[model samples]
Target: MSTPTLPCPGCPGRRNHGQYLCRTCWRSLPADTRGRLTRRDKRAVLRLQQLQQALAARTPLQIIRVSP
Candidate 1:
């Protein structure tokens, strides 16, 4: 006897769909891996880190316009 389960949102994981992703899908996520990033994932992470560093190094820009 087992409880009813639903199809995973990300993939067809045969588990309960209480969350957005099932356990299998969650485990398969690239971000969840430990020190084993693929080349593409690593590049993406590095790019994001660079963007964050650049943002932190500069002041935010603001624009104001008035019309009469």
Candidate 2:
């Protein structure tokens, strides 16, 4: 079975259902932000919110940051 995909939140590309951005857009994000987003701890939801807010504000991918 293949994973379902949807339009990426960060770009016009498609991404896996559970992913936040397409591969290219995800890679464009800073390493620290990537690490924080991947950590499924108590702050995970907040981190996702931060990302969404940044995207909504049209922040550049390379400088986007989420809470640690």
Candidate 3:
């Protein structure tokens, strides 16, 4: 049996073992800045980078909620 693979959060690709991102996504991540980063901080940085890319590719929309 082969190891179970998961879909990449950034792209439609399989994530590698023990990693949240696939090879392509991993390579696409922005370079780290000059500072100390905890594990949680690192994850947050990566997540934000992914979100920036995803948001940049689409048009923005405004939504309004109405209540009675």
Question: Which of the numbered candidates is closest to the native, going by highest lDDT?
Answer: 2
Pick the winner on TM-score between candidates 1 and 3: 3
- Candidate 3: regions farther than 4 A off: 1-4, 33-68
Candidate 3 lDDT score relative to the true structure: 0.46
lDDT of 2 by residue, 1-68 (tens): 45647989898888887788888999999999999999999999999999999999999999999999
Model 1 TM-score, 2 decimals: 0.31
RMSD of each: 16.5, 1.4, 11.1
Model 1 lDDT tens row, 1-68: 35538764444555553433356644554452312222355365564344334334542211111111
Show the lowest summed lDDT stretch of 10 residues, model 1: 59-68
Ten contiguous residues with the weakest lDDT in model 2: 1-10
What TM-score does each of the candidates earn?
0.31, 0.92, 0.43
User: Candidate 3, clashing residue pairs?
Assistant: none
User: Residue 14 in model 3: shift from native, Å?
Assistant: 0.4
Model 2 TM-score is: 0.92
Q: Which stretches of candidate 1 lie over 4 Å from their true place?
A: 1-4, 32-68
Checking candidate 2 for backbone clashes, the offending pairs are none
